[model samples]
Target: MNTMFDSSNPASAPRVWEVGALCHAIGDALQARFNPVAVRGEISGFSRAASGHCYFNLKDAGGQIRCAMFRRNAEQMGFYPRDGELVEVRGRLGVYEQRGDLQLVVEQLQRAGQGAWFEQFLRLKAKLEAEGLFDTARKRPLSTMPRGIGVVTSLGAAALHDVVTALRRRVPHIPVVIVPALVQGAQAPQSLVDALQKMYLLAQSGQGQEADLAQKSPLIDCILLVRGGGSMEDLWAFNDEQLARTVVQSPVPLISGVGHETDFTIADFCADLRAPTPTAAAELVAQPRELWLGALDLLQDRLESAVQRVLDRSAQRLDLAAQRLGRPSEQLSRNHLQLARQAQRLRHAMLFKLQRMTQNQQALQAQLPQSLQRRLEQQKQGLERMDLRLQLLDPRLVLQRGYALLTDTKGKPVTQIKQAPPGAALKAQLADGAVDVVVTQPRLL
Candidate 1:
């Protein structure tokens, strides 16, 4: 590199400088002449490098200027820098030596219409980010079922009403402790810090108004630092760097709901949780009551149905079990059939014996008269024979024929009539008739 300059001789040629030297001199002059500045322009060709550097062009109706935001300064940005968004950038004027291009090394950024105040907010955000206070690792997760919640905001702010209303609608039983504070104005920062401290003490002791409000409300599980929507200046109190640090170090997790969804603040970056609004934060902490009750009813119905099914199955089993036994009527019918068979056999045996006895009696009766007549006839014949023999011996034949029987006067037949009285009348005997002698006639001997 060489420089051409007029020598001390009069009428020397014009000065010339080497290309690098000239660029360096120009860059030095530009840096010294212009200092920290704010430029309003629309972003164009905005892109972030892999190394976390933002490269873009800030263009206006007239012209455009190149800009670069390094990783450190870019981390402080609350929203992505998109192309065509009007923005305000504050930084020093500089030149890229390698390219010899004029560019802005932006250290602060904000939406358009924000002037000095925006720059201050960015600087503070950058400072806190640099200190790692806004690190995601430092943020604690919100409790799933926090026993109690602490609120830090103005008592008169709409944000408080929104939060409390949402909480009551969702989980009315959960304890909420409010530590009132000024949400805006100069005193808001210290007031917020004091409210946070009071909630912390309430969590630790629960011996005062907080205890009375919620007798069972225990240690503060989380805190909500909220405020209604407002202008950047109105919400400036939340951007206090000290407040951000306090939120980061809170004993309980903190949720920041400082403004509308598009708005962001130091509190939002440093808090454990960030909600677009106070109501959203409340919804996040607890679920709606109706949802739980509906689930319980469904479970109860299922349980009852299951029990009924079991009972029906058991009753069916019992019916099947009872059917296994034979029917009583059938059993009795079988018993009766057996008894009838036994009775028939008994009746037949009795009839057979009675018939046999009746036959024997009839046979005896039929033979009795014949037997008696035979015996009586035999005796009568024997007597007739004897009578005939006697008649024959005594010439009874002549007597029976002539029918005469003579006897001595003594009625002695015969051989000896001596002893008979002569005066006695004689007796005659015949086979059919006999005449008796009147006298006591002695029979002839």
Candidate 2:
């Protein structure tokens, strides 16, 4: 490094300056003139390094300047910065010694109209809060097991892929219904409302009696409204008051997963649940299939144990009954002894009655012969008296006493003299014989 000087008028001669010293001199002048400056420009060629330092160019029609924002300052930014976005930065102007270039070291960076947007956001938030849309009591708990899931997002968004992938992995059996809509433009709020209303129609169809409507629409138990990370201006659609009101009208629980963890929107406050990311929203509605299967197995085991216990108790009761009952053979032997004693008493009574009847018949037989002999003697004496009376009146006895029996020739006895007439022949019956006779004279005497 040679130092050169002009020799004309030594005090006023130009001093020789080294390259490093000249660079230092320029840096000092910049620091004193505009050390802290605020510049508004469009960002260009912005990139973050591995060390968390951000490097970019801020440009306008007048000129462009190199800028650097360290990690500490970048973290404090409310929104992500991108190329072509108009932003205002407050920093110190300095010269880089190594490259001899002018640079700005940014201490803070914000969107060009961030203050106005922030005021609007705050006003909307306060209005909705007063209406109780953000109240915890208004928020419903998500279904533990959803029959079907409805998704509302752009068809081409990365958020759709993340949400669908998570749901399929956890609950492949459950069907998913996607209603695509714009999620970032001016029309995004109304598009989201229409998509949600379609899903609401499907949910109502399942509960109604309209079989046609139910058949045409797939039932959804819950809805997920999701979008990827973006700048505050890019995500302003979700902050719309109309979109927030539509979120509250969901028939089933609705989950809002609209940005990165650091982002917030009005829809998130009105929704039933809020998730930090799209994938997290899907996981909240789906439970793992293996977990449910484990619960079923536990219930089956409990039922089998209950049935086995009942059978064991029945067997114990049967054993106790058998112990209390005596043997059948002992009961039969006691009945047989009582029957034998009754038969013996009946046989002895029959023998005594037969003996008394036989003795009475023998006494009657001994008296019968004496009664017959007395009756025969009395009958013979009566017969003798009748015979004596008959002998006293006999006709032969009168003849033997010298009385004749006179009879006529015809053998008729003449009892009167008048019966014998003159010239009449007569027969006389003496005691020995009969004599014939004729009557000469008759007398009355």
Candidate 3:
């Protein structure tokens, strides 16, 4: 046999370099066999290639893994992870043919762990805000003095006792009804919400049944969710998204007093008002006895002052009227006497005016008869002159004076002989009669 190859074949066994090449090919085949995967880690060394591919290492405390995010994949991702940013990557594990190194081909990316939860919170907040759940118009105003108050909390919790004690201190006469339920743990969220609904139903139905006994309660006016301080996980029930939605959907006004002064939860945002502590919530809902007394005292002082002012004004008016009435009657009597004298003078002037009018009437009456007599005398003289003129103008009067008047045909007076024609009829008038005669011939003498 030959040293390089067996005598049966001219070919020799592959060299170390060739074997290395085969192993690289096997590794690439193996990488290609696996499908796309998702892995959550922090970005350790991130860099962008000129070809628009992102090269980065996904790392944790214990180990690190290299990854390559193509431009298409980067575009699909909502946010690109920066260095130290914890993220989840979905991709396939494959060997780089050029470098013979194993790497991830990223397809999708998203924030992981706490970042995921925060993002979810923001999404829920935005959804509720769009629905008008966090609107000021939806928030109910608290009653100034509610007849009954409802509390939802754990039975043995100190927060409950604190609220009860505070409420008693502020308003002893007001009634408080507790709906015991867990404020933490997996079942806490549902239990709190159920308790709230039960209280609301009881208030609406006018019936409150106890687990151990039966008793009816007055209408509940407000609900307070109180709990002690704890870590985010421990208080996770209060931060529940469903519970937050439930609080906003509740028709009654809700007061959230979860955790301590420094603690806050999602429930706090949905509630109508947030209190620093359970004690503070109770104090806000109830009026302090001392404060009520102070207000009453101020009102009393104002009433007294108002009454005094009114009395003072009335007394001043009465004094002024009395001073005016206290004057003597003699001055009034003298004024009346002056008025009477003025009236008498006016009456005398009127009587004088009447006397002058009577004298003028008598003068007119005396001149009436003389004026009538003068008119009658003038009328008689005028009548005599008209009579004389009538006698001179009358033809019968000339005849009566013994002078005959003659008229020819066509009734023309025969004062001139030339008026008659041959054989014309002529009329002669005496004093009382007229004679008709015929003119045989005309005498023009």
Candidate 4:
């Protein structure tokens, strides 16, 4: 029998492999065992490269694994993976031939049960959103020109320096109030609330002073709650429900500038405005002084132009009035000449009217005598004809012709026998006298 490790037996010697070949063999063994491996652990030092590839370490108390997610797989992730986030990954496990180390080529990655802290954050967010605390309608507009700005942050935070620097650079005239508070750990929430309350007091009544004395310190128009970028645990204070409620209670508009641009917290949703960074919050509250100055300059130019236009119009009116008036003495002389000409015309018109009237009166006098003679003759002839008509219509003339008039007792003329009945008393009226009589019987004809 031949022993495999026997030094004397060449046919039975163990095979030695190159480093690259050994790595390939181990990788092949790992693929055969678990090609589609799924792992669950907390992410550490997660980073996404400019090439869209991601590199991170998944670790547990007992072990850890190096993971790499290429651009394609990383793009499919629903949420950006941060350090200390618990996640599950599925990928091919293989050994890198370069450094001869084991690595995972991740095909899929997702949050591990949403993590405990993240789940709490979501629950609180949902609760607040239901209460309308996160409504866009509730969000207040930031003051375009805040009288003063208040900042609530840690004394040692770099966010404070960044905000102050930006504010100073943009609007040096605007005052800034710094209210130091704990921006991390469990105590940060209460500290931030207290700081904001103090700012409110200062804003309403300068440093607890009376309303009249509030001018001692510029009134705070808006407040900024800021902190530098950090992990979820490190920035957990901003997610506090109490802090979220307090953020909504700010007397002035509150601007939340916590963590990086990608980070979100409960306070951010409740704030009047959300800025990606502390410096951005400062920029939002205070517009550039140069911009305002430029606007004022434009207004001044417009005012000057308007004034010049008015002056030009007035000057033109004055010139027109001067041309119309000429000199006062010359104007008076012209008015006198016009008046004299009107007087001369009036005299000539009166003379002509008087002459015409006289001629008309002379002509009327000439015709008056003839008209009076003809009228008098015509009136005489009319009187003569009227006298003849009167003689013809006289009742005495009818009586003289032997005709008598009959009258009833009531003095009405009896033209019918019915008027003078048998028992009626009547009178016969002559031209010179009347005689009463009684009718025994009336006869017709």
Q: Give lDDT tens digits, candidate 4, residues 1-445.
A: 8535678888777788998999999999999999889999999989999999999999999999899999998875535788997888889999989999789999987777645676688789889999999989977788888888888999899999999999989999898877889999889889988988888888787545433445466688899999999877778899999889888888889999998887778899899999998888888988998887776556545534543454344345434433443222324446545644543454455446535644655523333345444553554454345335433444556666777778765656677778877778888867677788888977767
Best by TM-score: 4
Candidate 1's displacement at residue 141, Å, is 2.3
Q: What would the per-residue lDDT of candidate 1 be over residues 223-321, giving only the tens digit for each residue?
A: 888998887878888998778877877887889988888679889999898999888878887777677666655654553454345434434543443
Please rank every candidate by lDDT, starting with the best.
Answer: 4, 2, 1, 3
Candidate 3 residues 181-287, lDDT tens each? 88888899999888888877866665777666567776788889899876556677886777887887665678999887866677887899989888888888898
Q: Judged by lDDT, which candidate is best?
A: 4
- For residue 54, model 3's alpha carbon misses the true position, in angstroms, by 30
Off by over 4 Å in 2: 1-109, 113-115, 207-218, 327-445
Pairing residues by index, what is the TM-score of model 3?
0.44
Candidate 2: RMSD over Cα atoms?
44.7
Per-residue alpha-carbon lDDT of candidate 2 for residues 218-325, written as tens digits (9 for 90 to 100) = 578899999998878778999899888888999999999989987888899899999998999989998987776566556445533543453344334434433443
How big is the positional error of residue 383 in model 2, measured in Å on the Cα after superposition? 99
Better of 1 and 2 by lDDT: 2
Off by over 4 Å in 4: 1-79, 82-114, 205-215, 326-445
Q: Name the lDDT value of residue 406 in candidate 4.
A: 80
What lDDT score goes with residue 204 in model 1?
Answer: 70
lDDT of 2: 0.76
